[model samples]
Target: MSGQGPMRVLAAMSGGVDSAVAAARLRDAGHDVTGVHLALSAKPATMREGARGCCSVEDSRDARRCADVLDIPFYVWDLAARFREDVVEPFVAEYAAGRTPNPCLRCNEKIKFSAVLERARALGFDAVGTGHYARLSGSATGPTRPVLRRAADPDKDQSYVLGVLRPDQLDGALFPLGDTPKAEVRAEAAARGLVVAEKPDSHDICFIPSGDTRGFLAERIDEAPGEMVDPSGAVVGHHRGVHDFTVGQRHGLGIRRPAPDGRPRYVLGLEPVSRTVRVGPVEDLDVTTLSGADPVWLVDPPSGPLDCVVQVRAHGGTAGATVRVTADGVDVALAEPLRGVAPGQAAVFYRPDGGGDVVLGSATIAATA
Candidate 1:
């Protein structure tokens, strides 16, 4: 491993402090680097609404400026059609089927690692580098094989979204910001004279910049008004669409009557065919066992039970679990119940280690109990 030669790396510049600094670090390490920004919308917005969204004209320009400062070649790749096909449309379809899909995870799986990495290899690059907060074991050049691990910054760990990646994808990938915290990244960007040093991180979903998800969904899905029934099968209220409610939703149940025991009602389940939203006491939301499909194993496919920690959402809670690999998916029995885990959400697995949890595998939750 000593006296390793410099590698060719294609850095993804997202016009943010982290990405700008990531590109700088790669160049500082003497690797041949180039910058690229993804244009995710066909007709990109002229500017971002503060820190609400990204991939806008302003963001592209920012990325280009950073590339110029670093003296690296830069280009914008148009991936709007691919994004719509892979992330957006499937999001709508999943909601229609009464599932809560994670679009960011889908974007990483289909767009960045799949679409961009394929193109990068064709152009004679060694690996596709990003500002993602995740780590890989073994060599940094990516060819020696590496196991994905959690970032040093636990609060910003992005391993959950990246759990879908296969061994081939990991082979030519680089994450320079995995070991650094967010605060230090910003300071580094400012010291490097990057213009986006203080640019606040975009918080909302990219497509829905308005931050009104319900309004956006309502426009795409037709209203199928239905009843909101209690656990005992008694009608308590009504709603316009099953798409309007997700499991574990507490407010806006439209239930005029209160429970006999005076407990707050939460959405327990959705029946798309019946157009029914099941409302019940909060205790019903606690799910202990999860059955999933589309399993992606970063480790060897285990034939028996494996002890691991599982995360149900991007920034939500995680719990200790025992996982059994199934023929097509996984059976995870949680050590403690997690509230409101729904279908179409990823169940990312990690094995507890010394520094941070090492990503083992992931799957799409198909059913929960």
Candidate 2:
């Protein structure tokens, strides 16, 4: 919190409890703060018109109210044009290619850190802060400085989704609620009389309000009905589309061949080119190693082999792995076999010291072995 002047800070408020509380904290800390609500896309009529959630018109008003209570200026910036070109389009395209894309990661990378952050800088703001549950630290020397750490409340830590943040972005970023638990943050909001204090956490992607991603994709992408085949290439059933399924998925496969021992068959692979969904027993799904491409380093890249834990997805648990910073990307061989490593998911590396600092950056899941 040092080396910062009495400067302007733009706080990205998502009309959620955490972000509202973050804006209040920045105001209390004596910095000139402004609340910015990013309008992601057009409002859907079925969305109950005034729901104070992200991407909804109601949410923008809630953000304005929080700014009002904190006595800070508030504005709504339309980034839908860039959002479609950057996050939404890429998401649809990736899924069409049979990859399970992480749109939240894309939103953070292209929108929050790149577009919105740039806008803040252009407005003469010193830094842009958000309610993200991550911490940043380093000497305040240059733009390319700082290390990203997990929030104090491990249960609420969001560092995994933020591994894409560059060192320069981290230097100008602040997470006011990083050290506060969700319950405490809510309590502070209520004590301060904020309306969204009791609002539920926004979980689903903002654009797809109904959480029916398969349906959304069906409307957007041309469908090629595929066949469900066993590993031996025997046809089991028909699938609507291979893009709707992922590795280790069991429930929705429509194929009802009972297991010899009364177990359930899980999807083991997706062959997009062959237009087949490969199903097998659970043991066949175990993956002992994963290769990722285009890895970015948060701290300086490690010179040699380093031991750390890796998380393959946002909420996935950590697995023990030996991490080597390769010229192409990070190579991680899991000490224990992991199941369900899907392409296009994030694989984030964490320090073993439990400081919760993200040592390396995010990578696209490339191959599973």
Candidate 3:
């Protein structure tokens, strides 16, 4: 907490217990804190009923109430247009291209840390804090730059999603809930008389409020009927659209015929040009080598091959790998074969030391072998 003396901080309050407590904690720590609720939705008030999503008007009101209780200034910033362009549109497009995209990562990369942080700096704030469950070590004043680490609460660790942030962003970033447990955060919110103490966490994409990602995409992209084919290029069934299936998907494929071996078939790949959905055995999903494009390193890129643990998805297990930084990306050779390696998903690299708790950097998966 050194170098945090009375500096102005902008706390992104998401109308949840974690953020409410984060704002309160920053205030108590003597930082000149202001609470900001990002209005990222353009939906009319009538359409926001039941408002369980993060961008709902009800959530904004809740964030304002928390700021009032903490005796801090609160403001709502409209970023709906930017959110649509940066997060929402890309999410729909990536799925349309037959790749699973993490909108939270996109929001963190393009909107939250990039857009909001830049604006906060322009407004004379020293740093921006969030309720994210990730830890940071080192100081801006120190020789060593700050590094992102896993939260103490393993179940709530969010470093994987934050791997896209650069070192410059990490310098002015604050994660108030990083060292605290989720249960303790709720308890503190209750002690502070914050109403969001018992508020359930929003687990789905904010833009897709009803949690129907397929339906949301279906409305945006034109439906193109395609053939569901086996690995040998034989037609098995028909699919409404290529976007309806993802790699490693087994259920909800609408395929009536089971494999000849009387086993379930899993989606192996998607051919958008031919509009073919390829289904194969589950073993075909395993891959030992993965190559990723558009790499973003939190620290300096290594000159030679580096041993690390790579995580392919949010809340997924890590696999040991050797990473070689390439011109366009990084190539990862997994020690053990990993299943369900999907393009367009993040392949976050972590230091193998300290039980793989430190985030080194990340890249978008491009191909697997």
Against the true structure, what is every candidate's RMSD?
1.8, 2.1, 1.6
Model-by-model lDDT, in order?
Answer: 0.87, 0.81, 0.87
lDDT for each residue of candidate 3 in 65-184, tens digit (9 for 90 to 100): 999999999999999999999998998888788888888999999988989999999999988889999998765445668889999999999999999888887888888889999999
Using alpha carbons, what is the TM-score of model 3?
0.96
Which portions of model 3 miss their true places by more than 4 Å? 44-52, 140-143
**Backbone clashes in model 2, listed as residue pairs:** none
Tens digits of per-residue lDDT for model 1, 1-369: 112458888999988888889899889989899999999999888998998878889999999999999999999999999999999899988888889898999998999989999999899987788888988765635346568888888889898888888877777778888888988888889999999999989888898877777888999999999999998899999999888878888987778899999989999999899999999998899999999998988778888998888999987669999999877688999999999988889999888555437888899999999
Q: Which digits, one per residue and each the tens of the lDDT, describe model 2 over residues 228-256?
A: 88767888889877888888898988886
TM-score of each: 0.95, 0.94, 0.96
Q: Output the better candidate (1/2) by lDDT.
A: 1
Which ten-residue region of model 2 has the weakest summed lDDT?
A: 44-53
Evaluate model 1: give its lDDT. Answer: 0.87
**How displaced is residue 229 in candidate 3, in Å?**
1.2
Q: What pairs collide in candidate 3?
A: none
